[model samples]
Target chain A: MATLEIRDLHVSVDAENGPREILKGVDLTVKQGETHAIMGPNGSGKSTLAYSLAGHPKYTVTGGSVLLDGEDVLEMSVDERAKAGVFLAMQYPVEVPGVSVSNFLRTAATAVRGEAPKLRLWVKEVKEAMAALQMDPAFAERNVNEGFSGGEKKRHEILQLELLKPKIAILDETDSGLDVDALRIVSEGINRVRSTGEVGTLLVTHYTRILRYIQPDYVHVFAGGRIVESGGAELADKLENEGYEAYVKGGASE
Target chain B: MAEQNTTGSTTAGSIEVGTAGAGAQLAGPGTGRTTVHQPIDARVAVKPSFDVNDFPVPTGREEDWRFTPLHRLGGLHDGTAAAGERGEDKVGFTLPDGVTAETVGRDDARLGKAGTPVDRVAAQAFSGFEQALVVTVPKDAVLTEPVRIDVRGEGGVRFAHVVIDVKPFAEAVVVLNHEGTGTRAANVELLVGDGAKLTFVSVQDWDRDAVHAAQHSALVGRDASYKSVVVTFGGDLVRLHPRVSYAGPGGEAELFGLYFADAGQHLEHRLVIDHDTPHCRSNVAYKGALQGQDAHAVWVGDVLIRAAAVGTDTYELNRNLVLTDGARVDSIPNLEIETGEIVGAGHASATGRFDDEQLFYLQARGIPADEARRLVVRGFFAELLQQIGVAEVQDQLMEKIDAELEAAV
Candidate 1:
């Protein structure tokens, strides 16, 4: 039902020296219900694409056309983009002191859903989602990410993904700091949402270990600030065996 | 009164410059010491006195007065403004059973027992008031209701003094609510008796054109507990100095304050906790938020631990949240410890602007900019607000904070 198209997207970030381009003429299209795994090495602009689509002020879209269902996504404000159903699971979610998780979730849901959810049903919904994520009941009363462990932070991001239920959810390195058990738990949460078949996922990672669990429908090799190769899920297995060193060297020569 | 006068003069003693660890040992020099020397540190250099002449008018240069704007004080510091007669409704009190409230002459023996005037304004307030209101809770009595004193100021120069005395083994809560328009200077003395427990709250909700300065001095008695909460929301210029000293061993004090400043308003809080006795503890935490141009806030916390005060546990923390471009915050926390034998002593101060990343995180979840700002600001003050035990006061303060946020937007 929803489609995201990124055409020749050029993004720049203010580096210490000057404005440096990160995503150089990158293009991609993802439709609802599709799982696209963007595989890359460090500093290969995989995360840049995710943040740009979410409208982070840090990355300036120099030349790009990001359209969501024929609407210009690039012209929308960050919150507007979110209200239009785009979510970014940040690699490092900032700590918000004094804001309890329950309060934050309710506020966010009220903003996104355009009406405050019914109290009884909303509480029950949050309780059930947290239980599925194996989060403690007391976690709802805690300040957001105040003193959470790395695994706990990742789980919290997935909890938001499930609750917010955005049309396009970009998971930015969700498996980077997760342990084996945590990885399995988080992947299970993602697959549960994917089973709804109403959300498109852009799973950006530097490893193929997570692909083993989620089974991406499309795998894109990102190098030199753009996608250099695209294929089916078999490409993820090839990268698992051969590694990104091949594309890193080949993209540099281009 | 004679003993107080002698101590006041001897403690006013001499100023010692460039002396090592002089500030930590200068709390009470009249306890049998002949050659008393003042600490070079301006915070504790000036001794307390009941006479206004002993302290000179602050020209906004002294460390204690530097953060304060003297021009906006409406002549409370220099004794230039004429005192207008206060109406009968100026000061009113609501006392529960077993509690007494009366107006006593300044010559009463109980007037200056808790503390002497620390600065020129406090001394002026001490020497200027015609009568002092004294509220006392009887010995061994526990009150179910709070004692409320409402001081409503009419537009004029005014001087006021109040004393809250809790008898031995008594437990009570006191709320001092200040409102209306006035250029006023006040001194409040809190005396917690042996084995007594007291919680005192002072709310400064004045009019927009008011200028007010007050010193709150608390004496924690033997084995007693004292808690003071100062909330400042309205007023063009407001400065509060809350000081605590232990009267005996095993005393405990907790001082908490919250303030929000709007455009062209100056709110300052200065705190001093003197650990002059052994086995006493103190904690100070103050938080403030500023919005709009020229909205300034100052918080200075000074904790002195003398050598005689062994087994002392003290810590002071201050945090400021600047919510706009031109708002400013000055937070200074100073701890001077003369003994290494104490339990623990530390201080911390931090002033930070509204975080953009926090806003982004909230907005990414679909919260609008203004609502996100409100949430973050509310959360910033939530912890300190909960410490205020009175629910009605807390709700009112939250509403005021929301109004401040809305006005800023």
Candidate 2:
């Protein structure tokens, strides 16, 4: 079974003088066919976790290791990690103007599959995926994430997750800018793709609305670069009702 | 072959000069024309290395020479003298195996192409380097690695011309680099045979005080493809003219340019795609960024679908980003389609400042304002870089261009 393990992972950026630690000894384990939602407020290293896993150069991994199915993730390059069945649906997807979505998808899909997809079958698969997302076929011809609305960008990310079929998908605040209709469409797309029981997901978010669409097996509250609380699905409701002020102050005092 | 040398000095400067349009259509005797003349010893200017004929002068009437700077001929001279010896440090980039570079003067027997008349007046007046270096990629040759050619100009008036011949079924990437700290003008001719493909890159990183000028002429035959990418970041007055023609059916050509101009720099790019046959296609895209006082850049793209070029499909676009009040960019895209049976023909040109909406979007996403602008610029140029298709080279170029963008802002 596929798995994602982050053990004492630390990260930093290159500021003037020296590196500043961003991720401080954060540990987490996500198994295949499981949904784990990491809830956190703004500026609490949520996106940093996503970038550190994606091998963004600005975020240096000062210590700790990321493993996938017992293989060291830190040893792989960004593209290599991508090929190793690790996918990050960026909270703010990088807008690649002049690169068609279909073309970019095929390239990334080809990289994951270890070979170029057959032209005929690839077209059919992309069309079917677009239909499943209720997206116009012409969107594939448009540049990747270029001029896409807020909800469209999120849905596009889920569309990629569905088509690429990664072993462990990382959704970093994918629901932040989405509206109610967009959230439902995006979450429905995710649910349909994960229903096959072949993929696991780590859903990083702050809202519980998305969780209502796609249920999580485990809910973890992240504060001060570490998980402060872990519980079943009911934990998300409690946090939503009580707010994060108490936990944030309690963690800060420690 | 004999060496002739001449040394002369002339002083000419023009202030409050109007913008020189791409097609030289200003319509005045002194608008874009100037002449300079000074007397000096003849021995210092001559190049007698191999042998070449002096190119002829133009009356400012020829189609190819119409849009060029014509008034700089007052201080020009001709010579057959050998060039001054320079150490290896002056020249960079070792040639690949099986490739040969020979330095030949104007008097050489192979100076000009067969059946082409020599322009003696223009050759003597416009030549910058003393000798011409010719490189050849043999027939059926496939170079797994790129060939680097560095043309270094030490000082004084220098002119160099490079001739490249890619034989049939051959594939290669030829990087012609212009690097030096003096006045320079280099001309290059690329000839690709049937069923051959060539990715030619011209990187202009000349000294900031240098006046750089170049002309690239290429001919693509049946089933052949050619892609030229020009990146210019240095030089006081740099101008590149790329003239390409498709000689047979099913031929393709792409012209791409990226330029950044800062204070006191004037960079210009002129491209012409001549579709002489049916079923040929050509595309041109040139983008630039300009900042600071008197920073000016021009892009003129012309696609000509001749009468015989039925079924031809051509498109061209020129976009510029102006970053300062004193900076300016001029873009002109033209399409002249003679045949009505063509597949498609379109052209577009636009000039605008940074988009405030995009900046706000990125800033609202938690990116600092400055870094947000950087990301927007990266996102803007990423489309072009991705099309370059060479991962390592693209990454390296991206890092360098990113640094330039950061420094500019």
Candidate 3:
């Protein structure tokens, strides 16, 4: 099975006093065709985990390593890791003022594929994909994320995920700012892509509303930079009902 | 020093005077004195109605030339002339149909007059053209290609003038390229008729020893539109002054510029947008990057919204990126609004280092530090390329920027 494995990953941001540890020995794994949801409260290093796995320089990996199908992922650059079938739907995608969505998508796709997409067919395909997500065709002409509404930026991230067609995607708080309608649209889009591509998915979120749309194969509770517990899809239901207090109090004794 | 008389008194109120002629006093460094030269009735062969003496000397005192590097003058302004060679003409850049370049000017008249406001001077060493190459777009003519003007320099100083006229309802895109070596000067005049549209792009990519001075003036008529883009790449010193006026109602003007200065190069751009008539719109955006020790760049943008120019919409911005520790960029955006009740009139100017977040993002993407920096610079310029509107021209510009980035690293 194609698997992404994170082994006792320790991370920190460099400080004059020494490295201030952020993620302390966090471990997790997911296989292809599987959907894993990581639920955690604020300041639990969830975003740090996503950024570190994506090779963001600010979140240094002080110990351990990340591997994709036995290949060391920490060794690859950000774009290289992305090209190697790993996509991170950023929590806040930076707005590139002068780059149009069409242009940015074309370049990213071209970079991932190592060749230019066919000109005539490229336009038609992009239009169709945008339509599938219920996004306006005019959005393609606008600068990437520039002047976009909060929901629009989130939808844009999903659009890139659909177009880039990565093997596995780690979505960081993709549902944070999305409204009910936008969240539904975003969930539907994710479902459509996963069903079609049969790719592995890792959903990082604090809410359970999105779980109703895309049922997770497994749910893991994260606290203190480590996975405290792992269970079936019912685990998400438990967290949604009981909250993280039970796990937090239980983990306090460990 | 012995007295040297360059030019003697020719007539009453008219003097055949050369500041370089013996007896003409030259200013030395640390001399706080500013000499005011007597205005001479200067005559240029082409466009005799326009007087070259009225042009001001770009001193640091003027708001328009404040950001310019006056220290680079280094005693080079004393009687320095441009090398003018009238050989076979060549054209670059794809041009639309019905537009062509022709040489114009008489033997006694040359384009390009230099100096500060008081000591206004014209390059006399360069030969004058009897007839300036004219690019005429007939009335109702709509062009599908972009016209290119290729100006080449070998050595010394060269002066050439080109006049472009767009008749009513005519549309065209014109590109002028200054390539080769030595010091060169040019004056470009664009006259657009009512309801006409014209886009002009000037690219200065000369050899290391080259010094370029260019003046662009446009007279836009009622309901007409004019757009100009200037790119400065290679040169020891390059200065461009672009003046545009909406002389009639419903006119629109856009001025866009991008420059990349390497080590030891100094580039300056001065832009003036005059909103003379009502319902006119003008937008100006200029961006630049300076790298290497002592590489300096400047951008001066002035937008004048006269009282008569009601309902005018004007916006301007200048952004510069300093790559090296010793690199510097100075920018000034000036907006003069006469009427309080106007539609949108403002400007912004900024000069700083590369954004750390952008750099980190690119580096995380697997691009090395150098390549990542190049990507950021390229992306910074991509803003202009997006507005170029022409595929071939845009591709060529991108390629040129890529070459510059490669060599710069």
Candidate 4:
């Protein structure tokens, strides 16, 4: 079992005028086998928290302590954090030209597993995983994300998540730009990993439609760069009806 | 040529210049629609000659020589490097069945039939070499294996000439491999007969202290096809020019090049595709990677479509990847068109550093930084390596590329 803890996490980004703080005194905790949905409006710094844990160079941790099973997550390099079982499914995955999907998956699997997988078994594993997601077998031969459609990019990110099998998986707006069919396919993929009961999921999004597919153990209403309220799955239904207007007004006043 | 003029008079007379990135197409009325005239630009009007005196010695100021380091040419630009005798081991050839190789004197009737010398070094090489190696394929024959020619230098000054002739309806592949150290100037001529197909590969794997300058010219007959792959990896200073011209309509040509420049290495490639016949097609793609301080690579692509050459199609692309600081790349693409009745014409050039986002994307998957860099660099050159068409050479080139990347660290 693994757990990720973020305490008083304050993050800032360099702006035209000066350094601007985005995440202000945010605190969260996610344990294995649990799904946490962080819902927020535009510019609420929800994605900031996702990228901060991934060690993105754009975001700086001003004052915070991120611990993954008592290890200093904040001090780890991006790849080191990944080797420690942390994965980030970016909102907009980058295009890597000339790198075929099959080669990329194999290389990533080798790095994470600390040993090369048997070619015969690995090929079967990839084919089965691709078929489960309704992906065409020919996609394995294409360059990663090169000229891929929006839905296809999202599917590729989920594919990586399924293969890497990280301890802490952060899905940043994975449901955005996905059609109904694609959303179901990607959600099913995540559920397959979740069913393993060895992974913690942090799903960040602006809409509650994804909640219809994957239920969360806890729901956090994010506003003004921090989680304003936290509750069970019932809080999501409240936000869907009451909206974030009350919290936004309160955050601005403070 | 007169028949083409008669046909050109009936078409719309206009000139168009299409800039790749700007998406700007400038069209204007052409002068003397029926009469095909060369552009007044001096750079495109240099007449081909066989005499050294007809071309002046380069002074590092000419448009063709400006990017080249004249001092590092080891006197190939002038008459200072005298021709030296090479041992029997200096040049070797492995020919397949139905292919013939022989050394002939300058009086041979087929010498210089493909092209005449366009520069002083080439002209000097033409007038200096006592013997030329000629490889010929019979008519209507297709060889299953490729013809290999290995040229090894033992540290001397030499001038050389080579000719490859493919008869009508014949098909063949040729590989010219260069290695070892020397100061050399040479000329290569390729002749493709009507309905014939030829694929020629020239590799410059010279020693680190070697200096080489060469010009390759190909003449494609009616309905013939020609493909050339130029690979340059090992050299202190190497400059090569590959030019193509069609003999009749329905001819096609493809030129592909790959180069890797290490520290203190200078590699340059200049190409020209002359479309003087109707309905001929040509394509050019060249890619290079530069690493370490003082590593430089230059690529210049020039394509000209005359007024009488109706229904011409051409496109050229050049891309460079800079692996480290202190490396320089100069890429230029020039397209001149005189007929508006063509299918298409375009060119593109881009030079960029290793993308940080790509590196991050790989690293985020647990790949180390150095391994990520290698993956990206290998991916950058993967497409061109496949075009080489030789499995053994491709594997060797990959190993060389990996070694280059290892040294960069």
For candidate 2, write residues A54-167 as lDDT tens digits.
Answer: 676678888999999999989976666777888888787756555578756776677678778899999999898888888999899888678999888888888888878888
Compute the lDDT of residue B271 as modeled in candidate 1: 86
Write model 4 residue lDDT over B31-119, tens digit each, in one string.
Answer: 12232212222363345667787778888888788999988988777777753444222888889998999899887777776766777
Q: Candidate 1, residue B75: CA error in Å?
A: 0.8
lDDT of 3 by residue, B1-409 (tens): 1111123212111112222111122231122444311111122112111333334434566544455555554222333342233333344534466665555554322222111112222222122334555677889999887777776776654456676878899988888887887655556768778999998888898887677666677878899989888999988888787877665789888888999988889898877676656899888888899989888887767666656667888887788888988987766565555665467776667777877666554443334567667767887898878887878778888999999999885
lDDT at A127, model 4: 90
Query: Global lDDT for candidate 3?
Result: 0.72
Off by over 4 Å in 2: A1-144, A147-152, A156-254, B1-89, B107-130
lDDT of each: 0.84, 0.69, 0.72, 0.84
Rank order (by lDDT, best first): 1, 4, 3, 2
Q: Which window of ten consecutive residues has the lowest lDDT sum in model 4 chain B?
A: B20-29
RMSD to truth, every model: 6.2, 14.9, 10.7, 6.8
Candidate 2 docks with a DockQ of: 0.06
Better of 1 and 2 by TM-score: 1
Docking class of 4: medium
Q: Is the docking of candidate 1 incorrect, acceptable, medium or high quality?
A: medium
Across A119-218, the per-residue lDDT of candidate 3 in tens digits comes to 8888888988888888999999897677999889888889888887877788999999988999999999889888874578999998888999889999
Q: For candidate 2, lDDT tens digit of each residue in B130-227?
A: 56667777777888777787767675655666767777888877887777756555567677778888888887877776666666767787888888
Candidate 4 C-alpha error for residue B196, in Å: 2.2
